[model samples]
Target: MAQTNNATLIRREIITRLCRLFAEGRLEDIDRIALAMAPRNAQTNGSRCCIHKARAIIKYRIMALLGFNVADETDELESLYSYALRALAGTDRGEGVLTVVGEACTSCVKSNYVVSNLCRGCLASNCMVSCPKNAIVMENGQAKIDSLKCVGCGLCKEACPYHAIIYVPIPCEESCPVKAISQNSEGIEQIDYTKCIHCGRCMMACPFGAIMYKSHLISILHQMMKADKPVVAMLAPAVCGQFRASYGQLVTALGKLGFADIFEVAQGAELTARHEAEELGHVLATGQQFMATSCCPAWVELTEKHLTQLKPFVSETWTPMRYTAGLVRDKYPDAVVVFIGPCVAKQAEALKYPGVDYVMTFEELGSLMIARGIDLQVFEVEEQGAVIPERQFAASSGVLNSVAAYYSGEQIKPLVISGLHKKNMAVLRRLATGKHDWNMIEVMACEGGCLSGPGGVSSPDVARKLFNAQSGVHTEMLVQ
Candidate 1:
């Protein structure tokens, strides 16, 4: 099977290895196996100065998989093997959802402007002329930018007709929507937990695979292995097109993995739509300016943490995952409900809801399946009695469509905020200032909705194609 990207491939490889170890009951051997993962005796290291350094990086990755934060200062004296043993014993669980692998961080240059080889030493010197800071100077017929004086306005690059100036951004810093990621004194990237929304953009952005989240896989596997209580799998709508197998086949596969029941989060989305519509009607009756959807946890966190003024306008209804977990708990009171979805923000969101015992991403689910050697093709497709949700729910316009269905006769002016990036932040700020005409705003922190989530198995375009093809077959069988 073709991999999506290097980051996903590396993440999958680590998860797969950890799953294998857990399956084989080899927790005691993590130190030996993890150190031996890279070619320690090779003449040249694959990614570092020496094999030992490479092994160190692998150890940190292993620690992350075992549910330990690689950046935690308290764990500075602990060994990877010790962490593995603790995970196996089910003694210690990590404190944070995300961490930076300090050893793996490359400490990329902070300068945004660089003189590329494309510079032809043009006589006009448009770059120097356009630079407002006087940071750009002609040196030996080449444009030289003083890092100290440059303000990263990009005017010099924009003015140059040759496109000689290249902007070298710090990937993690640039990808962070809330400016939560920054370089420490030693130049290693650090995440401010208070400001972070756990979107996992930095994890995807870092080319060196420095940023990672502590996986709940081991805890989940332990729950299954114990079989003390029923374990239920709550799947997101994005799961529709994630696997090559049909929904029924995937359902059967989850049963084999020891899940007592499977619940579709989209079913909860249906409930959310009803609640939100009523809430919007109430808000409108009260003459409130506008309201934003609170289904996306990252967007909610963005409002609560950074955009305080917007908090009053956010919906009070629970997210699909939280609502679904509640339904599962009602059905099986003692069951440990595990939410399997595409968004990494769900990991942080799950913490707020006690009903949700664990949160695993689609990428993690794929790795778990691969590690367990569960072949979806061999599992015969059967009737799952699953509810097919609004197809738009998995994409950008789904929320608006669902809510609009409830208020059919009303003139509802809705705005869709696709992906919460820097530009979108400005728009949200304007909306918070009560300067917009929109009555409703549907915000998706990930572009193309949940399908393009950070933990998604396939690209949004491919996932959408697969989802549309399957929707026709499932639509007729849908309960509502």
Candidate 2:
């Protein structure tokens, strides 16, 4: 519950309800049962104006969970039961990784600046004088913002001595690093997939829970329930610190959830570390500029879509998830490899790699555990004999450390790009212009690396400590 956000809780409830219906073989009755249980009564209103409207929103959420495109106009008039039947029939998968529940979007004001009641109408007129765009004006003894002239530079807010000026950012727009989210003509938020990196930051930032991602939970569950072949669970390094239970217990729980085998993605990270280190060494030896790590799918996408100049310099190494899935495929040719991690971008990344059969976030996996009634605390820990990779790979500088450890004899001049913010773009621009001095660069789109991933279970602070402790346990082994 510590990691549970309002959005995460809502998603969990929807998934849990779907799983219950699936277990009871009552998927046909999902719409009626979910609506009844969601609002409980006419008095049980949620974020919407009434319980009925709230239930309507929930219906779309259930549709997204079933892999249906919530934004598809063709299904605009369809019922939730219809979508459920399609999902059960295994025919309709969503067209995109992200979608907006237009009904849930509150249509907040588009302006980023607002004149607050705290404006004292001071005679000094510091706010007025500081406005580079002359966006601030005084009327009726109160400060006002001229939306037409306001460029959102925030100079007026900074200059106001009374701190009366307030910056009211649209959460989704502000959180999106690439400015992919914008308001449609109807005032509903729409994502431009061309610019979107599938990072899920906008989804996490929206307070109204308006944004959501298409889930493959039902598809994965169907495969799990069938049990025709092996289903391998590939856990990311961030998994070490996700839950209250120990890692061993979590592995045992996966088995109980019908996974035929478990593999640590950290093993793949170890392989990536060596591969990246060697690649970096070769690049440096050949007198090429610095090489950026390509482990983060979002960062890779950001370069491909926006920073086209930097794409060629990005390391060609596969991410740990993909590399691990490849190994899983080599061993079990017909196995379903599910990559479980904190990354939402991996959902999109999985689509590009045939080795990966499915991708589920830590939040989604938590819901699956709840729906299956698998209590991690009570599960007996199974002895896992696999080689656990360096846990530092879960945090920002971990990749640098991993690659440095791999090339211990060389002096690896490293640059770390902790997050994809507006300021960090300047660095990438500099790198593109051949202005940087480093031999290797580590870039993670999410601040503090994968532990701060949008789909992460624990907060970055807590996850960092847990990941550090785990890293220390096998430090010597990792170096070897």
Candidate 3:
């Protein structure tokens, strides 16, 4: 996964500012967000062409945050305040998971390996010699590439002495693992929902801030403000590493945000592990070759959409979120359950289960904290329950370890898929052919697991360190 860049920071700022406006009871001024961020004659960020362009981009982003997909808008003159009114009213709007801002898209050139200006036209001509297609040649004191003959094999790029040969890629297109993103008739980027796994790679990859996921912030906030019924937060294990405070302090922060109660999803993770272990034992005993973990909704959706052959191999056990949502419903039947996690797939997953009413990313939660002026450092840490083994489920191998702690039927051989890139996906296809010897497989769509999800607020490495400090457990160990 790529590091956090200026694009992400800008989105975070907008979210925080919008939430602050709502918290301050000045939502009537919502349309002024763009003007406030980019006043007339104000110096624009170096990224855009001018202040007006920057403001248009900002307006589209706000539109998405207000649960309105910019692509669905027929009126170019629609005001941000109008969208705000519709969002708060929760009427006459379709809930879209993802949307693209065509105005913001730079429409990156077709992906190719080209010779750059830095080419020194070295005497040895390593680039020319290394080109299998003989597509590179010396001209005008710089190496030139023959577009028709170039195959994009990157051999010349590696052979260049001055590193002048470069491969320029369409940011959103290249980041997608399943080839779900492509260019439309006008050359603007478009997503194929039929092929997209909703792994959220494109949203995080776009340097131009063109792609966005519609948010349910206004709907969730409205329920909290009414205060007629319980509003419970189902916090995921990844929350342990998102903030600078202890788990208890994070719980207190949620309470201040009008949560009547907070339940740990890890509590449900423990039950999921136990049930999955039993299912795995039964599968192996019944002569099935292996079983795949079904915790990652993206991976599960990948099977349903792209990898149909692997669907049967996936365990039927419900995810921690589902189990947790069920628990909340059984306890408080009238409560509105909001799942808080570092996941984009959770939004799609929540739609399948009625127990969960909404899903909020940790980035969104952080913005709410900033908006409401809730400082985590000063809040007294609420006393927490005993930490369980399942608390380590935030990391990549933690799921397998938790299952290993419970499975006693047979000695297990584990295969862990830490990230779901193109190459790893091919391996999964081969696995479904019943040729592999591994008895158990665990997959996380993001590289380092839920901690590195697109919605994560902190880096996976830092998140792992903080989580480890609290649990004092070796979460990376796999089954024998």
Candidate 4:
């Protein structure tokens, strides 16, 4: 297995250096900076892969320049252009650095939304009136704040007759299931990193693109290029939806990027279907009323921390991505598995689970492809057979459909769960306490399933259209 901790440290060290370089105004030395940071060339180096390292370094550097504070308008082009001009100097031109830089440019600072521009200077003063304690005050024809006495009860923001008093929320904090995000004196969203489950929905909700996750693309790529580790690419089902291009074209592009083979996470979905079906049988046999699918990492993590009572109900099968990585590694002992999809939760998933070495979202892959100037439309590439997803595949009911296809007996009734938010909490509560009677359950954290994940590219509708087009090819029997 690759030493993930060591690789992460290397990434941090390089970013720290680049930060210092920027501060020194040696802007012209960007090429030297890229060369210095590139994954060590495999020919002369011991373990460094220049492409992978360059990708990691560039991403962190761009995040740093964006101030990493949650706020909107962080999606501006200057941040990307600046990083690109700096990273693509001389020898390191056309490297994976742009993947990092471009992604950073697209990220937003997820903030706790504070109200802006909609306040009413009303006479009834319902906002102040609603407060049990006098926390709100009106001054200069506007609502003024006094944090000392006011509890964050939110009554003033909620009770305002005009809906004018707005509550600004921190991006990540707002996205957290538990109210873990609290403001420090400085008004920055202070993360209880310990309390955080690493779900990364905040990274998605943030308009300013401030939040970031560590990258290990360089380390994995280096291993593939130098170690010749029979690297396999396991693409998630949501991938079909993210790209505007044909799915075949995207697979061909990955082949060109030097991946040894591409496997659909949908293949693993088949594995999940088989395993979960078996588990569901065992659950029913043992007189357990309902079994929940454990394949969705976000659902599992949330249930573990917040819905501990429901843990016993989750299915035991590994997720589609993990299942695929495990299957490939078993077949190819030297394989270094790279899972490409649209889930940030998968990054956290890789850290906890074995088999998977790296997780790159479609967003990241798009950046990588663009950085290399590989145009999907014009590339003369070979078509690999289409890979279809089986389990909790796309958005709503995707998993339910797969489960139904695999199970033949007893007329099973399965609950399809999506949108793991406060509103969806009631359903889980019902399932755990026996308020609902279903044979099985399929849950997705995002409202529209994996395609709507924080790491997703393209829209839900676009991804669905692509996925539907590819569904007919899997008429053959399942892979053993």
On TM-score, the candidate that comes out on top is 3
Task: Give me the runs in candidate 2 sitting further than 4 Å from their true place.
Answer: 1-3, 40-46, 88-92, 118-165, 382-387, 408-410, 469-480
Question: Per-residue alpha-carbon lDDT of model 1 for 339-389, expressed as tens digits?
Answer: 998877888888876789888888888898888898889987665454555
Each prediction's TM-score versus the true structure: 0.88, 0.88, 0.90, 0.72
Under the 3 Å rule for N, CA and C atoms, how many clashes does model 4 have?
Answer: 33
TM-score computed on alpha carbons, candidate 2: 0.88
lDDT, model 3: 0.84
For each candidate, what is the lDDT? 0.80, 0.80, 0.84, 0.61
* RMSD of every prediction: 3.9, 3.6, 3.4, 11.1
TM-score, cand. 1: 0.88
Residue 53 local lDDT, model 4: 49
Off by over 4 Å in 4: 1-129, 138-143, 157-171, 379-392, 471-480
What is residue 1's positional error in candidate 1, in angstroms? Answer: 18
Would you list the clashing residue pairs of candidate 2?
Answer: none
Model 3: per-residue Cα lDDT over 1-480, one tens digit each:
324678777888899999988878888888788888889999977889998899889999998888877788888898888888888787655544778888898877643787778888889899889989988767888888886688778888898878888889887887787888888867789888788788888988888879988887888888898888899999999877777878888888999999999999998999999999999999999999899999998899999998888899999999999999889988999999999998988888998778898889898999889889999999886665578778777778899889888998888889989888777877887987788799899998988788788887877787777777654354774532
Lowest summed lDDT over 10 consecutive residues: which window, candidate 1? 471-480
